[model samples]
Every structure is written in structure tokens, then in C-alpha cells.
Target: MDAHPGTEIVIDRDAGPAGKLAMSIRADRAFALGDFRIDGKLAGLHGQAWRLDATTDETTLSSSDLPAIRQLSRADATRQR
Candidate 1:
């Protein structure tokens, strides 16, 4: 997804398409995604990492959860406030 101008959009090449869309930011991550469809995957809350299906509804992640996410998915945590 194309980030808003002047926004930090982290593209994880190793993550492939999902990696490219995956980011390191926690605060207000929802605002960054303005009604976008993630083909083959439904965006879920933090910690779950790679599992989003019909059962999934909504997901939100915060700064406190960043460390584990970073470990699970490699990316620069430049979005942390």
C-alpha cells in the first residue's frame, strides 16, 4: 500500500507482497490503511502475525507489542513514537 506523503512506509522485501505491505508502526496503524483489500490475507491484530481468515474480524496492535512482532517479522522499527 502506498503510504501518505511524508509517511514512513516500511517495505520488507523478505516478506514478499505481504512483507511489502507489512510495517513496523503501531500507533494509529489503522488510519494508514484507508479501506484497502489485502488479497490472499485478511489483516489481523498484532501477535497473531500470519493468520487472517473468515473468523477474523478486526485487529489492532500497539507499541508494547512491537518487540515480538519485530522478532517474528524483520523490519526497521522506525515508526515507533
Candidate 2:
């Protein structure tokens, strides 16, 4: 989060399996969990930026790349080479 500051993250365990990871990037003018707002242009959709949801069997690693990920835990072997 060095590049972007004031990022808000929320993990809703009660939402779905393995829960939902919601990450809102920092905006020039944005609000998270806001009740209501009326503006012409909200800052990058005004706080609702990205969502990272992990399912029970979802993964970015291919079968061949599993070895590297098993070691690094979050490594993308395909991009390293």
C-alpha cells in the first residue's frame, strides 16, 4: 500500500464462503460505507474500487506453477521468467 494510502479494507465473513475481501483504493474525494451522496463525478466511483473474493477452490496458480506457489505462498512463477 505504499503507492496508495488511506485504502480501506473490509472482510465480511458472513457474506460468503471464505468471506469477501473488499478493498477501496484511495480517492481524491471518496467515502467508504457512506450513507448517501449526490455528486456529478464521484472519485473513481467514490470509494468502491476493487474486490478480491477467494472461493474454496479458486486459485491463480496453474498446475505447473503450483510448486513455486507452494514455496512462496503468493508467487506467480509465470511472471518471474
Candidate 3:
């Protein structure tokens, strides 16, 4: 999930009950939640904050999702190479 250089990736957390939902970004497209995975594209990042677009296969989601956005961002960052 390593974001491309100069790409913006944002993962927002603390918005659900499970407290473990997140979004992934790459470029212009985004992945919200799908078949057990959420993916997105890089939008932008400022300081310690990241801005990303959200997109997914599933049409909708419940209030509680898994893999907080923050965690997803962190994982993607770590995956960066």
C-alpha cells in the first residue's frame, strides 16, 4: 500500500464503533470498502495530516467498519518503498 512519491494518502479514524475503519488512496481514484477491502488514491498531505479520496466496490457500509483510516495510512506509509 505504499503511496507513490508525491502522492497524498489519508486515513481517518475514530469515526466508527469498531474504531478500526480506514481509507486508502493512490492518485485520483479511491477505495472505500469492498468485498473485505477498502482502497483509495492519494489526494494530499499537510504536516501530520493526510488528505485522500474514498472509493470502493460496495455500494454502502454500516456505521462500524474495520481498519481505521489512520491505521491504513500508517500501514501504507510503512509499505512505501
Candidate 4:
């Protein structure tokens, strides 16, 4: 998934629980905002340390509820002030 111009995600279907999913972030910047949903549930990543210079380089996230996700979509969370 291409989150932005310099940020992308690559999923490894076989790396997590039986039906769970795992992914790594490929980003050019030190931080990013990940916003999306899984199985109609909230699964967003924000305000996290995403150092591209670390030994691991990529940031990984896994969730059991992710396995049941059949679609990924984004919603505007902005509201009237």
C-alpha cells in the first residue's frame, strides 16, 4: 500500500498468525501517519517512532484482527472546529 509519495507498505501473508497479517513500512522520512481500517475496525498508526536509520530500518506491525480484513479504506477524520 502506497500511503504517500515516500511511504509504502509491504505485507507478508505468511509471517504472522494463522490468519493474521504482518507488514513493513518503507519510508524515506523519519516519521509517518498510517490511517486505515481492518474489517471495518479502527487500525491506525500515529505518533510513533519511525526511524529509517535504525538497524531494522523498516517498521513492522502485526495484528490478529488483520486476518479478517477483506478491504482497506480511508476516512477523513477532520471535523469542524
Candidate 5:
């Protein structure tokens, strides 16, 4: 996501669930949760924005990345990363 950003992503066993992370997730990015709480970090976060945006309503900006965030399945939500 850092290299090229989109709206969202899904990870099953196919996406290499665990490995040395390849990219940095910006703080603007976030995790989209399922009905239940999940124990994993949102990978490819595209959240590496360390510098804050000017005039960004933090509350609103916090969720701005929602389109790119994906929810974990009920089972995946509880699975440890």
C-alpha cells in the first residue's frame, strides 16, 4: 500500500499472513474491524504519515483512511498475528 495506494485490501492464507513487513503504515491509516475485535495489525497500512496534515479534523482524518482499511473475519479477528 505504501508504494501504491488503493481503497482496501483483504488477506487470507494467500497474502502471506506473517512475514518481515515490507512497508511502513502511515498513522492516517487504520484498521477496519469486524463485528468482533481483532488481534492483528492492519498490514500495508499506508499509514506512515508522520507529519500531521494542516486543517485536518483529526476525528475526521482518523477515519479518512477507512476506504483503504479492511475488516478481519470473525475468526481472523481473534487470531493473534
Candidate 6:
């Protein structure tokens, strides 16, 4: 999905039955559950790793692995390299 300039994208995944893994992405980097926003650009995504700025963060993510996100990730990677 194409996000607006300042749109907030929330990635949520059910952790077993009673818990969840959530991440909010806005601006550049993808934020974890702590609400920390990283500055720069979202490089791409591979498996469950979110490449932001020049660093890669790995987690048990869901949205990043979705078909739409995967397509975006491929585009991002192509542009970067």
C-alpha cells in the first residue's frame, strides 16, 4: 500500500493467542512496539527483516512478509541497487 507522506502504518501480528507483535512505521524507519521512529528511508524488506536507513532490523513480523509489502520491498531493493 502506498502511504501518504506522514501516514502511520501499523504492522500487527498475533503472538500465539494472548499477545501480539506490533510495529508502527512513519516517516523513514519502522518503529517497534516502543514507538521509536527512525529517520532516513525504508530500504526494503526480506523475509521478516525490515531494512531501514542503512540498517536492518529483524523480528517475527507479518505485514512485511505480505504479498503487497513483498512487492514494495522488491521495488525498493531494485531502486537501491
For model 2 the TM-score comes to 0.23
lDDT of 1 by residue, 1-81 (tens): 434433343334445433343444322323533332233222334445533222233343322233433443333233233
Off by over 4 Å in 2: 16-75
> The CA-based lDDT of model 1 is what?
0.36
TM-scores for all predictions? 0.23, 0.23, 0.24, 0.37, 0.18, 0.26
The deviation in Å at residue 72 for candidate 4 is: 6.4
Please tell me which predicted candidate would have the highest TM-score against the true structure: 4
lDDT of 2 by residue, 1-81 (tens): 122343333323334354443222223334342221123111212212333233433311122222221333223334346
Clashes of each: 0, 0, 23, 0, 9, 0
For model 2, what is the error of residue 50's alpha carbon versus the real structure, in angstroms, after optimal superposition? 6.8
The segments of candidate 6 whose C-alpha lies over 4 angstroms from its true place after superposition are 1-6, 15-65
Considering lDDT, where higher is better, how would the candidates rank from best to worst? Answer: 4, 6, 3, 1, 5, 2
Collision count of model 3:
23
State the lDDT of candidate 5 residue by residue for 11-71, as single tens digits.
3322233432121123234434222233443333234321233353221212223223343
Please report, in order, the local distance difference test score of every candidate based on alpha carbons: 0.36, 0.28, 0.37, 0.44, 0.30, 0.43
Name the regions of candidate 5 deviating beyond 4 angstroms.
Answer: 1-38, 48-61, 71-81
RMSD of 2: 15.3
TM for candidate 3 is 0.24
- The C-alpha local distance difference test score for the whole of candidate 3 amounts to 0.37
Tell me the tens digit of each residue's lDDT in model 6 across 1-81.
Answer: 434454465656653354545343544434433332233334344434443432444223334334545454354455568
Which pairs clash in model 2?
none
Q: How many backbone clashes does candidate 5 have?
A: 9
Worst 10 residues of 1 by lDDT: 33-42
